[model samples]
Target: MIRRRPPAPLQDAALVAVSLIDVSAHFDAGEPLRMACAVASAFSLLLRRRLPLLTFLLTLPTVLFSDAVIASLVALFTLASLSRHRTLLAVCAMAFTLSDMTSLPSPNLDLAQTATLITLGYTAATAAAPVFLGQLVQTRRDLSLRLAEISEVRDHEQLLTAQAVLAKERAQLAREMHDVVSHQVSLIAVRAGALQVGTADADAKEAAATIRRLSVQTLDELRHMVSVLRASGGRPTELTPQPSLADLQQLVSGSGIEAKLMTDLPHDLPPTLQRAVYRTVQEALTNVRKHAPGATASLHIRHEGDAVRVTVTNTAPTRPALPLPSAHHGLVGLRQRAALLGGTITSGPTPDGGYELCLELPAEGTA
Candidate 1:
């Protein structure tokens, strides 16, 4: 439960009212000096919040001659609550006691001793209670702050544990796909390639050749997915080498489509933008080979004002094609990559029985 702090002005007003009554009562009893001292001490409580130590010291001497004890008590409480140094408070307590007790005149032995004990007891009680209560309040606040920090740390640990478990399951699935499924697909491709070369009939050779090409493309995509899953953890995985714009020619060389590149791109591209450009071109050409086997394709990369633009366009297939295997999420992933870097990508059918893909990304430090 939260504790509400009392307002300072209200507390000060209450102290002043009580001290005024006490002063009036002493004045009616024919004690003019006591009345003056009481009024001064009462008004001093107004500065307790601002200057606690000074208020306490200034009001201490008035307690010996005046009946205005409320201001002195409140000052003591303010001093204890505001300051944390114990040695300074101890010195103030000693000074208050010595100043008050030394103001007395000579008297009888037994009476003096009794008065000494009572004064010492009241002074100790006045100082001890506030100091003890102040320390208690401070300790409770410290403990509450520490508990809040511990709860946040525990929640963060649980979240990390859940993510780690999910990543482990993904890695396991990727390994199974790579080791079992890819191996079978490779065997099928090998058989189909042999049949395409050795068969006598034209239709049989065409069907086998189509099967072989699709199988090889499927294997390449599957390998890429497995490598990505394996690299998801804290430690690095020795996956396939990353492709860059430097390998554009190698990528388009034997793709079985008429592909060309037009570029004025600089050699020093930021790593992330460079990788995104390479992957965009790779996936675009791969889609052309799958859906439009004999299409003429063109890739253009240009550095416009503060932006790098990439456009891929391909004409309609010139020959009958086989229905290739596809999950159709490549463009979706490419669009997401562009959006994450504050870029845009648009793709649609062109006016002349063709397809076009365009991407625009900032040339600055998007990573």
Candidate 2:
């Protein structure tokens, strides 16, 4: 079962009441100065969330002058939970330990005495308990947020994978229908029309015309279905704007890697080739950012003979990369795209521990 945190105001009120009770239990009206300090320490719990250091300083007077240490401990905990500076937290914890230990009018600080040593140890442990608990709370909160973000990204990636699969299947089906089924249907309609024009019998001529009309209607419907299939996933992000060589500059600029692009390709390439080249560079840069953190990349595209070649190269990563969530579909998608365009995709580590992705496509793309 999941637990919910209490409302902020309610938690603050509870801490303030607890602090006040601790103060009242330790101080009497006869010592007005200690009483005043205790009251101030108790009320300072209200600022623990927003001004933890101030709250801790305000409560320190009570710990120094009286035995009411609960308010100061809470303030130390608040500061520990909110602050990231380890040195600051250690100093604050030490301050709490000293203040609690010196609460007496004539404090005993002789470490040689067993009783004094025991008192110091006890006071140190008390101060440490809240600091450790507060640090633990801070770590748990950070871990929860990271887990939430990871979960959200995983779900979104899964959705995109499903959409990509659907789009690929639809495009393949459309190709089959247009290339085979449509060709066969058109031939049948042509043969029927020829029979209608040559046959002498009226019944036979009428039958041929009917067959021709039905075949034509079926062909029209198949055309519509094929168009629909080709246009599938247009609403989704898989294949929105048809990218070309002109967009490569923008893609490299926004890839977050120190990247360079050099291209000298013919401007009359097919849309399929342009998009494939664009995606190859995009995926290579993304991999650099993910697996090869702090790597610089260069993309080179050139036309040689009857083939267009694209290469993306990155230097060695400066530091070890974190274990980012990955499904390993980016390169697989690149391979599938190359196959569809009658091209080849190759990727491997370079000599200097860098990475390279190369794509080669026929000048006359299959698509």
Candidate 3:
């Protein structure tokens, strides 16, 4: 950070030169000595950071002894810069005049000539210092303040750029989900509706019923995903139902994975929390469908004190394994949802040669 200080060396040198020239013109004799004393006094005032009071005291001795009119003028300027009250400057001026008058021998000259010259010298120095230094300080202060403001503006612009990039990525993910999952669910829904209208065989009717149920479940999941995207406007006034531990059986059956479910859950769970649990299970099963078709799966849901735990495991397919196209976005979304609800999820291949997913969520408000 920049700190405020007295004028730069070059500026101080220039001002000292001006002070010497103006003060020296007043003296009829000892011109060189008077000019030297004036410059010395100006240098002392400029060197001391705190209002030059000691410099003013030092200048007093020079002003008293020297016949140099310039030395007295420099002392008066130092006093004006150092003191706030005009009365103090006036008092110093009078004292310096008396000292100069006393130093001179009794001569043809009277008090009037000495007093008039002293008054003119003191007045000029006092008026000049403030006009010059006041403008300098004001300009420096304005420049410092402007630079600080510019730095803050640049920092804010960088923060805004980072936020814009994150928002663009989120929007792109939303569009892709809509295209993939929504399209698949819509096709399933249309096929089920047609089968309901035209199918007469018992097996055909049963197949249609299964398709309709899965289609509706998939539609509900899509709606929740969309709601999450839209919630960025603000907290949603109403949250869509989220699938939880209770929905594991239906999710497995609907996905055509031969599955078994074992659970020790309470009769009820908080809807918000249950949804997180359900989505974790749902995502795991969807991965199984895509990567391990014809594999058997097992889901376990257990309630421990203050938390509900879920684990889903699916065996690897017997057929030659195909490299499934990954949608890493689904896992990213699942992890985010779990974190928002104060939960955790883990997915990997199990030691027993099956894909496994484990999830845990707080049950504070859940039964």
Q: Note the Cα lDDT for every prediction shown.
A: 0.72, 0.81, 0.62
Candidate 2 pairs with clashing backbones = none
Q: State every prediction's TM-score relative to the real structure.
A: 0.47, 0.60, 0.45
User: Candidate 2, overall lDDT?
Assistant: 0.81
Report backbone clashes per prediction.
Answer: 0, 0, 3
Count of backbone collisions in candidate 1: 0
Q: Which pairs of residues collide in model 3?
A: 242-275, 243-278, 244-278
User: What TM-score number comes out for model 1?
Assistant: 0.47
Per-residue C-alpha lDDT of model 3 across residues 20-52, encoded as one tens digit per residue: 665555444655564466556656646544554
Per-residue lDDT of model 2, residues 1-367, tens digit only: 9899899999999999998888878768788989898998899899999999999999998999898989999999999898999899889889888887785677767778899889888999999898999999999999999999999999999999998889877876665554346545655665576677779999999999998888878877886787788777322223445667888898788666689899998667888788778878877776776678668998889988888999999999987653333335457657877887779999999999999899999897421
lDDT of 1 by residue, 1-367 (tens): 9898679688789887887776676563566666677788889888988999888876876767654566676677778777889888777766665544554333222425777788777867766776677667767767888999999999999999988876766665564454346545655665576678779999999999999998979987886786677666332221244556787787677455688999888868876677678767877876776666568999999999899999999999765554444445467656766776778899988888789999999999532
Which model scores highest in lDDT? 2
Q: Could you tell me the TM-score of candidate 3?
A: 0.45
Q: Which stretches of candidate 2 lie over 4 Å from their true place?
A: 104-112, 200-211, 232-367
Best TM-score goes to which candidate?
2
